[model samples]
Target: MQDTIRRNGSWLRAAGIVVAAVAVSAGTTLPAAADTDSWSYLTKMQAHEMWKIADGSGVTVAVIDSGVKDGSGWKIDSVLPGVSYIEPPFERPDYVYPPHDDFVGHGTTMTAAIVGDGSSGGPKGLAPGAKVLPIRTSVGTPMAFAVASEAAKGIRYAADNGAKIINLSLGWTPDWPMDKVKPAVEYAQSKGLLIFAAMGNEGEGKNWTNAIAGLPGVIGVGAVDPTGKAMPFSSHGPDTDLTSVGSKVEIRCAENKGWCTGNGGTSFATSLASASAALVWSAHPDWTANQVARVLIQTAGAPTDGSKRSDWVGYGVARPRKVLLDHEGDPGAPDVDPLAAPAAPKTPAPGTDPTAAAAAPRAEAADAESGLSWQWPALGAVAAVGLGLAATVIVKRRRS
Candidate 1:
């Protein structure tokens, strides 16, 4: 049966599912550091200076996206065994769904932005001491319902495992109802997982609302440029809870095909937000999800217009430097959620003892920075999958 994804009540063009990578070669030349750049705002915030205090050690961020590429020079220190929900084309005998295999390259960029080691000339991650749990889902297809369901499964799986933070650098069109994945997000929060999601990239004129970012307790992140202005392309809505430098960012593509630059999107901003949380959570391993979120909100750059929060920049830009370097903000009560989402009763998973003790935070040393150079490629358009008939997806852009 053919799965069709519709947009604006009309069936859009569909394409054949791309083949999953059984094994990818790692011989492509990486981009040079001198030729590429990172988030200029992060540099101004002195993220490197803050790293001395905490580099996201003892934290695990679940990256639920198209897929993440695992290999040398990828800046990933450790990638845990992850799950995949991508259906094979025709159930071929040679089909193998590798969770870490990234064909779209979007997930790879998101991962590198969070924990990339900066060894292969790629951008240094904000949380270099953290581990990544890759949760691969269906993308590039037209079945929005299937895609959303897979993403929900990924969230639950990450929460049950050891993910302290979840990065959802993906979203659907404005009209796509988020009910399918909303419960899973709540379940993750109930389990003490902090989720950061993109607010979409429809810009000011066509600024569409993304409910995933607006979900209670989910940190909805938007994009801002160097001058503390919301990017014209950044989605704006009541759910917008935070902002990050989303313009002119650097990223590492799969297949060793060097680095790419001139990229901007809520997806990248979400990754940065996740990394910021990791840094705080690692420094204070015992803090509950709510406390960490409260601190992040309290320490974030406030709106330049003197407002507490806004539809465009949320609580201003995410600034971990204050929390790490200056020790600003209060973690607040551990039991209270900062985003104001009511806590759901925790339910034990099947076959698991409810009395089992929660696992202790992992203790890992931050990796040393490497001198290998890398570059960022121009953002390119790729196929995005989602559910419902009234939604449309913004093409992932590449600036070459």
Candidate 2:
């Protein structure tokens, strides 16, 4: 879910060198700013402004990534013991693992970004009070190739463990077909899980895979800079459902030893977006996943025209604040599947290889036609005018 972004024109050139230098000097020790209380602090005030009306206090989000170190005190105490898809020993039957044993701080950092308390001057998560369920799979792994199986396994495990919202920040080049994991994803959705996945960070590298986001029942997230511009490195396309503050969005880094800092990419954006859903769900626990998703898409801050949806920005930037605060927002149908593809075969028959069959060129084409689309009505004239009035008030307040 994580990737670095260029500062801008000239900063883009120096970005690679800067990351390399930082990686070398920092070694496995994340940069000093990576500490929760040090550099990337998202103030309580800011959090309130961003998501106070929709604080995700009671919602539970399952983080499927590298393992999270609960010992860091960053996670809420109510977190259930997580399950792992990695091999035995590494995949403990019980939840707790070795203390402070985050092989890569990526998981922990992401956890903080989604639900950190901001107690340590760390970046405050959009849903600061939400509980987290950490499922370790790819953290500390060698590369994408080494962990595809484990990643899929973790997703299944998380679904089986009563997670209502699942957040995945990892990706693979040759994506593991959804057919291979559709059953697990369907199981999770049946149990009312809202899955949020990164759209990938390889927009510049043509081979990037948008599998998780492309699949039905998943919210594909792209990245945007602080100024609300789409990042060049952030993946884009019709597959993307929403965008978020990705670049310069401060967060705890995987490098620093139990510290927090700033990083960028659709990965962090995905976490933030997931946390937003958690908050909305927490506020309205009775609403189904589809309803929650409908609110998000319907209230998303973007233009209404389908063609206007930039491959870079998707439907528009995600605005959890708008969804949470708007009184007239619709949550959509409770029983409907937001990602269901009408034409695709429900499941592979007895002995067939779902992946091999689904991966064939023709199958890919068929799936594309059956992919998910947004059917929510446009923000009506009244809602648009109301939002404009609110924005004006906000701007005036800021000016004062």
Candidate 3:
């Protein structure tokens, strides 16, 4: 009896455990003004202070999504030669980029968030100086089976290339158990690539399950609002590494022209998290991925009572500004991986009960009363995974 939530004029079931399309709020806006409007998120995070120390100039982050579109203001050189896993045999097997017909604005929006350097009339990126490696999985549907293989190949490609960070805005389903993709995740980490992924946008909906939110070495990001509080819709209960501003974010759309304010989800949060990593890595070029991860966790803005972590907010909103400007981050040991899960890896057998899988009880409201009845839809995607994290977050998913 999963809770069903309706978003953007459609009913979505949580039983399926998928991160669906964007929930749009209708409003018209002029193109962003130089320092105000859609790009206000930068100001809220005090990004300028961090900018003085590190602008992500030397780092390259790989955006694994639908496709990345460039606006006129975007630097032609900053966007490296990327490859697409979608479309026909149009691109060479080794290197390619996205075609124009991106179904939704997801991938483009993410690119803007991570590294768009505002030009004549373009929006400024959080890591304007950092390069983005756009890897497209398909036109739409993050969960489709064909897209799954593409995403895995894309991860390996990103690592083998010069990608220092990889951002995965899409999620996978727990029912499908994305075991196929684990090897690729391991490969990227072995290459010292810092990976960040979205926690899914199902908190307010049916409160569905999430996959790999607690996967070892993968940083899982959640969302927060303007006041620096976790949104009620942000899925809680652990497996989240940190929080970032993700509500009503405005970005240049992938398929269309101009900015979109409707973008919201852990996907966007992951981009900001990815950008934060770029800023740090760019500043301290000699630091290892573990040092960056430890600093992010150590300097994260946590509870006033002084706990090291939070389930919903994770370590709290990423404070890269605090890390760089205030010198508050401890780089710690260079070799220690910060996101390691407590236990050894083990795959659950088929039909393993989800409740038993849910490790920690959610710190928020009690579980939804289970009387609601709704038919689960058949969306054959192995992509949408992670979240409803609980046990994975609280208990150690990696060995100590």
Candidate 4:
């Protein structure tokens, strides 16, 4: 059920789970203009502002997706020598097998979205100082049995490695069971590595949740438009844990010589969430994954509808600024899992006032100047072309 289509000068994959090959414009002229107005500010995540507190130094985020290529204006020095789970007979002939060569371009884009260094007009990631561990897997054939097994292996690999956060911008169809990957997810959680997954993009019509997002250990993320509203295509229901800005963002693409604008889904939103965790972890290296996750949920802008939590936007849009800039939200206990089923009752850390943090005004939609804007060097005429493709791949194995 993952058909790819071109619309409004960009490609959109019908499913919201895996990374789809986004087609970009060929040899188009791009202005060197910096996106001073970060799309993250719409939800008050404030990447630029958060950087002032922490650039994710000494932190590594594992991107389990298509291979991450070098020279995409990303901080190549920060990209580690990562592992790949791809085997022979590639599903897509255009794809490069190595963990560093990304012909499919989805992994590269997701990597840049988290840690790109804004070189040569590339997208400046939320945590540019963080290292990205690329764990290559099948992109074109997401639903394949090999893909799930590889993803499970990739999670364990990331856990064994130095990755503090695992970004899963991929998932299978809602009805497809993730029995193959659950143990790996549990293993990652046991190792204190936080896992973030995209809550599929099939919207309400599908009305079903998919793994690894629906899995117990993973934090399921939904997509929100620039106006701080849940995207129509963003999958919803009980599985959603948090939300972030996911549409009309810039990205490095394989199909284009220059950066392309993505009509993002949960894929992009998951990256933002991972980057935010990187920032928090970088600043407080002593904090546990549980603490970081708790603060993020506590500081997040509550659902715009004034609800404690909503399926549409989860606990509301992620506003890391409240934690990084204002130092609000108690980190609570280090061992308590915030997202536990029948969620563990959390008491505020000693001398930390959770009520004061809750009293703060809810985050409102803001324009470019109002959000976290990246100050790139004076690159003349950096053009941001029309909205490029943002394809969402669905991972569903063929059932007899």
Residue range 194-290, candidate 3, lDDT tens digits: 9887776656554442455556777877777655666555555356777776655665432345664543557677888899999999999999898
- Per-residue C-alpha lDDT of model 1 across residues 314-374, encoded as one tens digit per residue: 7777878788888998987898767674323335567764222122111111110111011
RMSD to truth, every model: 13.3, 14.9, 9.3, 11.3
Error of model 4, residue 346, in angstroms: 22
Per-residue lDDT tens digits for candidate 2, residues 89-192, read 23343433332334445566667777776555444566777877877663443332334565567667777776788987765444334444556666777777
lDDT per residue as tens, model 4, 1-400: 0112122112213211112212211123223354444444423455667787899998999998767778877765889989878774333434335788653456777788788887766667888899999998765332233566788899999999999999987756323345657788889989999999887655634333445665665678877777777766566655677787776666543342456555446777888889888988998999999889889888776765566676677777676777788898889888877776364344556886433422323332222111200100000001101111122322222101
lDDT of each: 0.64, 0.54, 0.62, 0.64
Best by lDDT: 1
Cα distance off (Å), candidate 4, residue 288: 0.9
Ranking by TM-score: 1, 3, 4, 2
Per-prediction TM-score: 0.76, 0.69, 0.75, 0.75
Candidate 4 has a TM-score of 0.75
Estimate the TM-score for candidate 3: 0.75
Q: Which stretches of candidate 1 lie over 4 Å from their true place?
A: 1-39, 75-77, 141-145, 174-177, 252-256, 341-382, 385-400
For candidate 2, the per-residue lDDT at 247 reads 45
Quick one: how many clashes does candidate 3 have? 27
